[model samples]
Target: MTRYEFVARAHAEGYSPPKEVTFAPSTRSEPHTHDQLSFVYVVAGTFILNTDRAAPAYQPGETCLLDANVAHAEEAGPQGATILVARKSGRVAETG
Candidate 1:
């Protein structure tokens, strides 16, 4: 497995605020960290979310929550995949 290099800029769709990213077939991303808490929703194809502790496969419609500054990586399935990534910076509201 090779380390994936992440681009500095966020990929997005026209007129849309959220970042949209696409992976090439058999693509593997290098471990990296995000500036803020984020969520990645898998729109098509499959991928594996790799972290320091675990690696889990994510399919279409599956969503993953990533904490701010957490180091992680991603591996795309053979057909590649499209994902929507949104970010936020704040504390989550607690339910009592």
Candidate 2:
């Protein structure tokens, strides 16, 4: 979806305003978790989102949603990536 659509959807879903984040070329992040529901929209280059079940590549105008506290990691494509992220704060129930 386009950035406009992404932001509109995110806001409708209760996410806070988005903030831009830039990842360096070939960069990778250690597995991590966020306390809030996360929404990410790729603005430039590529973003590889890694989860236990899959790793999907996101191009410009693409977006991804991650549930609160879900374990995941990120990798930046060779040319690097810029993304907009919005989050919704809330407690997520623990699952077995």
TM-score of 1: 0.74
Q: Model 2 over residues 35-64: C-alpha lDDT tens digits?
A: 998889999999999999999999999888
The TM-scores, one per candidate, come to: 0.74, 0.87
Tens digits of per-residue lDDT for model 1 on 1-96? 001111112233111245678999999998998777676777788978889889888887677767777789888999998887767663234246
Q: Model 2 Cα RMSD, Å?
A: 3.1
Scored against the true structure, residue 8 in model 2 reaches a CA lDDT of 93
Which residue pairs in candidate 2 collide? none
